[model samples]
Target: MTFATFIKNTTQFLFKAGFIFWLILAILELLMPGFVIYYINMQLWLIVVCCLAVARAFLCKEISPPKADAPMAQK
Candidate 1:
């Protein structure tokens, strides 16, 4: 794959990972009660947001037409 494609895929992976991370963070926040949890929760949220934003940027690229992959078609 080309560099751009690699980056796009990485971003997509990161975005999906962020969803899982967010869920884990929510669960941890619910299960535990402490000042440290609050700090960790805030940091995780920021990282997740950044991941989503970077993935969104990759998805909005105007330089190339959308790729037609079998994985997408399966959905």
Candidate 2:
């Protein structure tokens, strides 16, 4: 695979993972009154993870595109 494809796939994976983690935390918080602290901590971590994932998705780029005369190579 190419670098761009790798970045896209990894970013999407991270986003999905983060979303699932946050969802679980939310459900736990709703189900248990004593889980406030856990909820807060999880929320903070989730925010950080989401930010990092977005940054990685936006910032990562392939160094160069394949030239018209060049054969494409898989990463």
Candidate 3:
């Protein structure tokens, strides 16, 4: 595969994996009780995963249009 395709696939994979991890953590939090410290830790982890996912998506090895070029897509 080309470098661009590889980067895209890797980024997508990481994002999906992070989302799934966060979902499982959220479910565990809901099912369990009286674990305030664990809940807070999970929440922090979820935030980190979400941030990493977004960063991976945005910083993938692909070129994006600049602001001037991007405006045309909205029309």
Q: Give a tens-digit lDDT track for model 2, residues 1-75.
A: 999778777777777787877788778877986686643677577787879676776766557866687666879
Top model by lDDT, which number?
2
Model 3 error, position 11 (Å): 1.7
Per-residue lDDT of candidate 1, residues 1-75 (tens digit): 998778777777777777777777777777775624746656767677786777668675778776776565554
After superposing candidate 2, which stretches have Cα over 4 Å from the reference? Answer: 56-75
Q: Least lDDT summed over 10 consecutive residues: which range in candidate 1?
A: 33-42
lDDT of 3 by residue, 1-75 (tens): 999778778777877887787677677666776544454676677677787777786767467566564445554
Per-model C-alpha lDDT, please?
0.71, 0.74, 0.71
Give candidate 3 regions above 4 Å deviation.
Answer: 34-40, 59-75
TM-score of 2: 0.53
Against the hidden reference, what TM-scores do the models get? 0.54, 0.53, 0.51
